[model samples]
Target: MGVVEALVGATVFDGETRRHGVAVLVTDGRIAAVLPEHAVPAGAVVTDLGGGLLTAGFIDAQVNGGGGVMLNDGPTADAMAAIARAHRPYGTTALLPTLITDTPAATAAAIAAAIEAAPTRPGVIGLHLEGPHLAPARRGAHVAELMRPLTEADADQLVAATEAIGVLMVTVAVEQAPPRLIRRLADGGVVVSLGHTDATYDDVVRAVDAGARGATHLFNAMSPLGHRAPGMAGAALDAGSLWCGLIADGHHVHPATLGIAIRGKRGPGRCFLVTDAMSTVGTEGTTFLLNGRTARRENGRLTLDDGTLAGADIDMAASVRLLVERVGVDADEALRMASAWPADYLGIAEMRGRIRAGLQADLVHLSDRLEVKATWIAGERDEA
Candidate 1:
């Protein structure tokens, strides 16, 4: 009925596994079918990729900045559009424009920007509020002065805001915000995540009970797992109900450590990848401001003058490459970590994360070397 196109000749990673000599049909900006190459319908337009890897486009839930624009700099629709354009080249079809620790007024501005941008910006799914309600001691690049406990009024505002913005993910320290607030946020359709905390195992469990379903940049800003104490990191790995977002830039986490987290994490709750990218992601710029302090990008790492690690400087494609080449992750599973897992965590898998029928036709074609050759966002192809 609608205009139909077939993509053939690639090893298709259908979000969960790989299939060979397959063809995917796109109609009206959604996948119509995935079948063998020979099964393509008559008169269907076809594009043969010549034997490379085809998979769902990367979905990053944590993106601080890109395209020379940081959310902290503008927190406007224009800034969100710029960030989306910057990451598109690297195969990220959808992302959450993250706002790190900032003032309450700044937070409100960011939410307003996201609400204004979401309808027009196809790539921005929602907003990731990463702080302002974090533990001061673990606030890596956040301004300690700005970090505070979550008040009832703040909780009500966040809940109300989610009605306008589709997904409002707030990263809070459970040690600071009580279980009741976590429950309130979850009840209000906010995706509550735990991060930047010094909470022990019990605290994390209590947060989980209150519907905190994810961990922010696990093992980086949170308390480490102790053999005797079992902190938030331990709970993250042990909890089968939580999804942990890992920064696989090979800088925030060691290769061996990442491998362990990947293997140790149980099902229904897996470790997925996030770029945690900064302003240097798609631009040649090497430095940016984080909470008014200079965050310089050198040697593939972003850090403050005092060597405190800020957001990462990697992109989604690079994160996938690092996971496969350095961390010894299976290519298929690594791809899932970048796309499907994150989509599932964000509760958008049915539409955006996979190459199955009825899903939006968001996909990427990568060469044997894992370089992005082209990307299709909602069935519109952009060739590199």
Candidate 2:
């Protein structure tokens, strides 16, 4: 490969709601310049994309597993690889391996495995432990038997491992997860998200007040925003400043509800997309393995045999497509939910999220019909 590749005629987006004519210059795996079409760098090996739609590399903040490999399956490298290859094709260039509520030993093993795998697999940004430190009252699919208090030792261990991880996200309830533990995790550079809780408005405020950064799978695992109660979801929406992730598969959250969030959290940094998919994503069949239990995917949704909603069968790229097709949203605005927003939420805003100068040349090229034609991860372009 050349030192730089000038992508000519491609309409590049900065992972924000702005579209313009630009030729991207990538060098050493970073965006060196976003030049006007007329200003292609001399001898830059110009690649005329025929004006394909170029957006930032997709980020799925909440990915369970894909490719028939569950990351929660003992945190082994094979499991992580299964998770990576599963989403990589559907335009998920980066992701967080989500582990559900489990025993302390299991949680620790997951963390260690995530840390070990993250470095080798750059697309695996970090680990998202969705439970063990959550509210049982709102535990949607997590095993209730394994839920527990937010122990300091657990926080310390996750933090210590994060010294090696680029990011670490934990979904917890302010009422269930200890306050100081959340604060400490945030202070130590771990991203704290509130979810699976029946927290009151004040409780939501306190979590944010205590330095929680975002909400995981908004409107699915948290309390609804009832006018009379306006509980945790209400507080999150009302706060109006925190970053929230929505599973916009049109299954987990309705387009109308997503529209309401789009209006409510409209100011600066508000909402994004996450595919809370379990292990069955990107597979041809319906059955999957979750916590070693039989899981099923029916009608584009994943559920336990008892018809309990486990997670999702959607990927982040498909989520963007759903937003455009279902919500009638602007493509740029909708794309932010998967790329820029999640990057900023993880505190890797400078590098991972946007298609701009000096940012990583991680991007996706799609056809007019929104089909992902190619995905570039760490500068290695994969056309599929």
Candidate 3:
């Protein structure tokens, strides 16, 4: 019953196919219709986008900071808002504010902040707790001294947090969190993901059985695939039910390996793109601190002084470009990896990540060169 606006002329990629000369009608923050250009209502406010490509906005499952602000700096609603505002122009309309390995107090603060911020922050889909519970041997960029096993108390707190905050994703090492704890978190509606692990294939299989449905930044902090062993990396590729998040920056994963992951993974579940981005993403800074150590950004990659990979400097638009121009993924599939697949992985596909009637009108408009022209979150243009 609210105002209806039509987005016209651009090619609309509706999460499945790209259609030409169509108009997307949005009413009351939801998609009201998708029709031929000629069918747009006579009185509807129309925004013609020339020949740009309009698709679902990118959804990043891991974002630490942006706009010179890191989540670890404040762990407050204002900090979350700053991060969201900073990334909105880069084509990310929704994201999980990731808290990397930190003290228990810091973790709790981040959780509380995300819960408080989600209702007010349009781009904040949820929070991703990347660890305190992880394998120290595989804890890349995380403080080794802070790594610990998941306790019953920890599990209980997570369950309660999930109840308070919808779409809570916890990335843990399978070798650390017992199968029972994994099941408990999953049953309580927490997305349990395997990450920072050196677990063997068998260990990963057991974790999968207990509802660990995803892997965080595959092949980076985890054990690599061996010819005979097929460690955590191999298990992630082999597990048909598991979704793997890939950093498509061409540094974290080579294009050849990215191609293999795209071709080899059996799905219902598929490999999707995640920024695993840090404070340097949408800002001018070339350095930031992670757990009291400085991570320098150089040559489009973030690394510690010791040269361990920290996070990434890539944004959603750049990742899509890499997939299309370098990795040879079709443009539509590349867009889906940045948008729809992440939505599906987060279990929010029905309401977002697609262009359809009754779905939230979250869209990104891209120029022919694949650069971000503009983005809309829930039908409102982000002016940032």
Tell me the whole-model lDDT of each prediction, alpha carbons only: 0.92, 0.81, 0.91
Please give, for residues 178-234, the per-residue lDDT of candidate 2 as tens digits: 677888998888899999988888888888878888888888877888879988778
Q: Which candidate's lDDT is highest?
A: 1
Writing each residue's lDDT as its tens digit, candidate 1 over 1-384 gives 688999998999998778998899999989999999999999999999998899999999999999888999879988988998899989999999999989888999999998998778878888999988999989888888889999999999999989788878999998779999999999999999999999999999999999998999999998999999889999999999999999999899999999999999977899999999999988888888887889898999999999999899999999999999999999989999989999899888889888999999999999998889999988999985
Pull out the clashing pairs in model 2: 272-337, 273-337
Candidate 1 error regions (>4 Å): none
Candidates in descending lDDT order: 1, 3, 2
Task: Write the number of the candidate with greater TM-score, choosing between 1 and 2.
Answer: 1
**Model 2, total clashes:** 2
Compared with the true structure, what per-residue lDDT tens digits does model 3 show for residues 90-141? Answer: 8999998889889999999998998898878889877999998999999888
TM-score of 2: 0.95
Ranking by TM-score: 3, 1, 2
Taking all chains together, each candidate's TM-score versus the true structure is 0.98, 0.95, 0.98
True-structure RMSD, every candidate: 1.0, 1.7, 1.0
